[model samples]
Target chain A: MRKKGLSLVTALSILSALVWLAGLAWVLQDQFFADNINRQAETLKPDTAQQQKEDSSGKTLQIAAIGDSLTRGTGDPDGKGYIGYLKEDLAKKTKKRIELTNSAIKGQTSVQLLKQIQQPQIKRQIKNADVILLTIGGNDLFRGGQALEELESKTINKTEDVYLSNLKAIYKKIRMLNKNGIIYHVGLYNPFSDMQDSKTTSSIVRKWNYDSANAAAAQPNIIYVPTFDLFELNVNDYLYSDHFHPNKQGYQLIGERTASLIHFREEDQK
Target chain B: MNKLVHNELLKLFRKKRLFVIILIIAALVPLFTYAQYQEVKTTREKLGNVDWRTQLQQEIVDTQNRLSSSRMQDDWRKYLKIRLAQQQYYLDHNINPQAPGAPTFMRVFVENSIDLLLPLLVMVVAADLVSSEASGGTIKLLLTRPVKRWRILLSKYLALILSVSFIVTASAVLSYAISGVVFGYGGWGMPLLTGFSTSGEELVTNTVHLIPQWQYILMEFGLVWFVCLVVGTLTFMLSVLLRSTAAVMGIMLAALIAGAILSNMVSSWESAKYLFMVNLSLTDYISGMATPIEGMSLGFSLIVLLVWAIGGLVVSFAVFTKKDVY
Candidate 1:
């Protein structure tokens, strides 16, 4: 009986291991394999001229969001970051298909983004995008050092003017990438709102946001959304344990605020 | 000792373990070879109908068009774009992508053996050797013979080593013979372009090289032997730990499966670099990209395997010398 029990346990263990592998494969396959399969299926679907015209309406309303971890669903306990809600909100407000493709890596900077713009993959996304969004410039100011603890200790000292100029370079690069792409620059928010440095950071952030907003004004098709207003004082409600990234509620607000920009665009288009 | 060896060989003939191991090797080698056969068949089919180079060039253009609008976050997508572009460039410039000379079948086998199934057969044979004798109580009878204890164990070890080498070589031979039946043995001499990276712009030394197909097969046979020995030594360690034949096989199999899992998810853990599974897959480095884990240099992985082999050797010797069976 003990031997039989042992064999049963071994069988159970192997089965569980296989199930784990199958589940993981199902998820990754759903992502990579499903894209190809779905695309193939879509290709086979007949595209009537009337259907093409209907799809065209959705194209101008499409929002293409690009950013660092914040835009990539980093802080949200749920998988929905600002982009997710913005997608949903615009869909409901316009009652049309408001599509979004998030092109955000965990650790990317404005300088890297400028380089990314030159890459063929990023270039195509920029060219056809009706609405473009970005939350870059953090990694450029503070380089990632593998660990958060190390990042805190190895922080660099740069004045407000230097940060503003770098932010200016990023906006300029985006304009150069797409002369006609409608743009949104989500302003930087304070994670450490309780501390005195929050004010200092907020002021610097305001200056940075001012430059972003100012630059957007210079370009005709750009919109600057102040994300700092959503979560500056509500630390307990929004920030995650790391005290840096947003919690689910904070991201909801960010998404709604960003979606509000899309809603405004949709109304103007109508 | 020669008479004992003859008797042991007779005993092995009657029992199913050795036959089962050989049967398994024969069965599995064909599985992978057949998979390769199917893929090549499909490629040949596509090649027959269209200009193969033009199809590849069109794929490159399509990938470029898709990539032109992204933030470029996915590394795999970037790698594909780079690869397709380089292939396109080679075709565009009228430079041969497949190179001029041909590699021998032997060299190709050795290079590709680590990728598929030969290591699996090694597990089957090595996991059962000593522990099966112990579990059957045949070990007591073998010890009772006129031969010295150390000499008897040493002889069994030598037998396993010889059989392992033969089995590994047999697997490669079986694959070539069987795959030749289906693939029809063409392109055995075509030069294969390897060790090129389009990740960077400079096109740093495409490193075109060639060898006969037969030599490639032999080198692959030797590489398979190394890999089997590593796996055999690991199973041998498990056999010592469990002492029961079935238990040893189970534990080693579990370890094999787990090691594969841990290596893939081991993003931050430095200690996972020491694992044999990650160490054994060094062929990826030869492809000119960094390993799955950062800081896991090829040299570090080899040293870790050497350490494990040495540790296994020391344990087997110590236990075989001192253990009592009453």
Candidate 2:
């Protein structure tokens, strides 16, 4: 009986080890080789033609916003970045249902945003958008004030060159994915206009805004919305405590300006 | 042979060490649960009247802001990117992030509990298995039996493996039972999103895998079990070589702790990936955590761990059968 019991215990131990080995094999296969099971869940029947017919009665305007923290609505205590406020304003004025998908990630540089545009989800959203809003180039130029302390003319010029080329690539990629949608690239504002070196920083920001606006001008439906003048006089009042992101009132001003631009285009289309 | 194995099992159960492990786990469950409760209260207070969609968006922004600072390390940035992707996913789907409840807490406990605490506890049992017999001079009497020395050593190893399984299962049950009292037993069916890239390169938010909470828990169990098996077998080999239980336990415990510290500190070093302790965290791969080094993968880690386990087993059997008792 004792011998029998020992053999049984040995058999059980071996079996358990085999089970563990099998589990490892299974997990390995699942982790590396398993095709996405969620793909089927994402597939919706293509209904663009049917949706357009329904939209004539009462259309739902689709807005896809991308770029950095400003687009993400950081520093706004109300949690509605400028895009959120813009959605509300556009919905109220147009009296049409508005669907907003904010794909913006905070602190994203121009290169990161360019990479983000390649994601399938972002590409799909951009394709369906009637209007695309973006806020970039702040992180590229400012880099959270690290670039300011170590400012050199050569470095600034080199960085700006890389940024502009990246911006152009981003525009080309978006246009490739979406040809008809109007792209509104919100220009940078000088948050440090009230600082001791306000004059120098202001000049650099103006040059950045001018070059960026020119970049947008080269694209067919792209328009550059300027926020420099809005924050020029009351920089302190428009900025949050961090002195980097805009306060709630500042976002409201931006939202209103962007809405006005979209409003006129909607009227032209009608 | 059966009676010898039974006697070894009896000897392990009679010790106070096993009970101490149980008591410690029982005490930890409620402490973790209360801590989770406090966390949820503060988050809800901060998010008063705001919906989960906006809250998730804010969380993404917060992680991004933290990642922007030059002071942040690359390791932390990688982790933050994963967090950012998860929050982005919740926002995209309009899924209200699950609040800190019993099921969510239990799930987290299963996912993370193995990293340090469970391994330490299991090592205690494994480290004592053979060394104590030698220190107490009981090996002489045990060897005098009709069974061969190899059979005796194998039986002890088998008992240690059994005890490791028991301890792990008990931990799971205790955590589930205790946390269930407060959080309720309703989250088994909730869909859990896994497979967010921790690679700090381009954010690939599209490759996430969705599995139910129950299935995820089962996978975590399997992974944790594999880790414990490797740890237990290795420690048992150490216990066989050392005469004093204290020395065996101390060395294994130090190795376990050091592995954790190295995995955190020099994870960038390619050589660090070959350490068995560093490779113990197989759950990281399943949950899509960033690999400690650049090129380490789930397959690479598993192969490393399996090689160590097999080598330790071979050395243990070979050495114990040949070494003279005198």
Candidate 3:
């Protein structure tokens, strides 16, 4: 019996050795010699397209947030930003499960965001979103506080024109992807509102917000949510140590406002 | 020669090292599967019923956010940049790089284990192959046989090869069988992208191509097998040199653990790439992860490991044939 067992084990080991040898040879053939094969043309069909269609009836509230650092929760110590707090608020208000996808990159400007939404996965996320939360124009206007230092109207005008056009394109793309999803375009706040040149920066920010709000108004199901007033009263308290981004209290206030808008809409729908 | 190899196999089996190795794999696979399952569950809970695309998208965004931070190390930034681009490529192709299934689990399991866990397991079997026989004074009886010394050594090496193959296959089968219970037994035909090469921080996709997951896993297992064989060969060499099995195991253990540590910090120490332990992660190249050191490619790692294995084999034969035995 022991001899028989030994033979059986030997046979199995020999067989696996041959199998691994073949695998090694195949690696050499596939990784090195397959360059002549036309590989770039083989496009993969989106596997999730059918899966997405099948699961829409479950009624989970899909919240897709996009754009710059604010949406990404940059200044908030918890890294939840307004969107995280907004998620918490909405969770408290609604019985439905809130599914949130924050595809926000810090320091992303409007042009970069326009490019980001063009990605297939981002497009798919937008398509499935029941409510879209957007925060942009901060990096375009602020340039990480660089704009505040220079305050050059000509350069700012150039940036704003490019930004407004990109914003219009982004809005058009989101609307095209999802006709019914409510777009809450979170407006920018003047971080330098308490500074010595508060008048110049405040007017620049207000004009930026007004123009962005106009763009939001032009699109269907898009609401321009104002955050200018939230930080305007106590800018120092709301601003993070960087003097640029919002602190936790500031993000919480923004979250509450966005959540309230979403909350009442959920109530109205019910 | 075949009968001699058969004799060596009998000895190896009698020791039950193969059985013990398989048992270890079987015991650990479920642990990893549970950990992986919990990770998937937590991600699902966080994202709420989203598809793998959203999960992958979130990862890409998170990497991008990390890259944007100024406080990150330069090499880390480069790694993230390359990974972000690769994730983007996977997203663009509509292929879910992490589709859930037994095959996917097996791939992840092997990829992670190739560098250290698998090598250590191979070490456990190989460390004592010749040293134990020498320490036990069985070398005198074995060498007293009429067979040529090289032939006997070759048979023992063949048996070691067979056992290495057995251990790798056991890991593959056990991980699949155990993880399949939780992750399901599908995704073999899932399409995946490969051939993503990095030039500095940039991901060069000109040569990128699509291959099914099964072929990808096969190729990766091939790389894993090669890595294990090289590590096994080095351990076998150590076994032949030292009379004490403990000494052989200790040296191999220290070198392997050091390799694991060095791969993390060796981005600045470029020449460290030539070490066999650093090259043991041959599977990483097949999967297109950033090389621990720049200029280390699949070809480079394969060549380095081959040279080391050949060197080990040469030393084992030379010293085993000429060494004085009491």
Model 3 TM-score, all chains together: 0.94
Over B1-326, each residue of candidate 3 has an lDDT whose tens digit, in order, gives: 99999999888888988889999999999999999999888988877655787788889999998888899888888888888888887787777777789999999999999989999999988999899999999999999989888898899899999989889899999999999999999999988777777888888877677788898888888888999999999999999999999999999999999999999888889899899888888777777889899998888889999999999999999999999889
Task: Note the residue pairs that clash in candidate 3.
Answer: none
Error of 1 at A242 (Å): 34
TM-score of chain A of each: 0.67, 0.78, 0.92
In the range A47-69, model 3's lDDT, one tens digit per residue, is: 56553533364457888999989
Two-chain complex of model 2, DockQ on C-alpha atoms against the true structure:
0.13
Q: Relative to the unseen true structure, what is the Cα RMSD of model 2?
A: 8.3
Two-chain DockQ for model 1: 0.02
List model 1 lDDT by residue over B52-125, tens digit each. Answer: 43345435444644554456655445555556655644443333333211223333344455533555666776
- Per-residue lDDT of A32 in model 2: 71
Using Cα atoms, each model's DockQ against the true complex is: 0.02, 0.13, 0.62
What's the CA error at residue B239 for candidate 3, in Å? 2.1
Score chain A of model 3 by TM-score against the reference chain A: 0.92
Tens digit of per-residue lDDT, candidate 2, span A1-270: 645644554455555555545655666655677686566336432234432322223366878899999998888999798998888778777755676767787789999999878754567668777889999999998984355675666778888898999999999999988888899999999998888878878888898899999999998999999999999998889899999999999999999999888863365333
lDDT of 1 at A117: 58
Poorest stretch of ten by lDDT in candidate 2 chain A = A49-58
Question: In model 3, how large is the Cα lDDT of residue A173?
Answer: 94
